[model samples]
Target: MAQLGIIGHKGRMGQALQQAIADAGHAIAGGVDAGDDAAQLADNCDVLIDFSAPAALEGNLHAAVGAGVPLVIGTTGLTQAHHTAIDNAARVVPILQTGNTSLGVTLLAHLVREAATRLGPDWDIEIVEMHHRMKVDAPSGTAILLGEAAAEGRGIELAAHRESGRDGHTGAREKGAIGFAALRGGTVAGDHSVIFAGNEERITLSHLAENRMIFANGAVKAAAWLIGKQPGRYTMAQVLGL
Candidate 1:
């Protein structure tokens, strides 16, 4: 069994991951909580699983690399600078990153892209997502991933077509625009829906997360898969063989 070290041990997701790993017959070598030093835990574990915030990701990743451990990162809200750092780190160790780790969500993203390709520009794409109140990011990383898939299907860049949060005096929905909406509420696990609106009918592709363990399970699976992988960056799509 793999010995895992968890970053962000005090947080909800971190605790959930700890329990999930133990339930899966894996061992927690150590962990770092809100105010603890994650590097110390990394030094003692076989692999590191991170579900920390954007602010903590760099340090956590650096610790894993310094400790010579593969990493599975489930943290979201990372900036472009963070992406660059992750790419650089992958040169030294295997790394897997995903916005949403539920297998169903990953499949939904794939199917959404396929639908976008088949439906063409005539159908307008809109993504609506909701998460728990404590989540800090707006227009979640998962939303961006789904949007990227739609943009890829249409042979366009996501930055050129993203329309987040409509304000007063907004004009008509531009052709090929991918709209995004976010909602935060009490104790909601997660929800995402991709809406395709056409002249005749509308189709909605959606996924609901009932438990956080789905993500924890995916992270564990990713860590296991990364055990002997070549130094590179990977994603849930690669993990699920999509």
Candidate 2:
């Protein structure tokens, strides 16, 4: 059995991961929260799963590389610098990083990409997501993940073709642009929908997360799949063999 470690032991996701690891029949190497020595926990585990703050990511990557173990990063709201850090660290150790770990969401992104590819540029794409009230990030990472998928299928850069938070005299929607809307309230686990609007018809794809356990379970499964993998960057798509 794989010995799994948690990097944000006190957080909600971290707590849920504990139960998930047990349910998956894996051993818990240990866990660490803010100010805890992540290097210590990494040394004892075959793989690491991080659901911690963005500020702690660099240190976590360092610890994983030092321990020569794989890492699964489920933390969201990461900036470009954070991604660059992950890319650099991935050169030294296997790392599976994703905005959403749910298997359903992964497949949804695959479908979104396929749909975007088949549809003409005239179809406007919009992504909407909802999360718990306590969530700090707007547009939820899953929304961005889905937007990226659509962008890839359209052979465009999401950063250049994305729009969000519309208000006052926003004028007309740009053609071929991907729009995003975020909602927060009522302890919602998570909900995301992608809409493709054409001239006469509309198609919407969605995934609703009922609980954090789904994410926790997927993280554990990904951690197990990452063990002994070659040093490189990976995604949930790879984990699901999509």
Best by TM-score: 2
For residues 1-242, write the lDDT of model 2, one tens digit per residue.
99999999789999999999999999999999999889989999999999999999999999999999999999999999999999999999999999999999999999999999999698999999999899999989899999999999999999999999998999899988999999999999999999999989999999999999999999999999998899999999999999
Model 1 lDDT per residue over 74-149, tens place: 8899898999999999999999988887788889989998999999999999999999998889899889989998
Q: Each candidate: what lDDT?
A: 0.89, 0.95
lDDT of 2 at 61: 95
Clashes of 2: 0
Q: Which window of 10 residues has the lowest lDDT sum in candidate 1?
A: 30-39
Candidate achieving the largest lDDT: 2
Which portions of model 2 miss their true places by more than 4 Å? none
Off by over 4 Å in 1: none
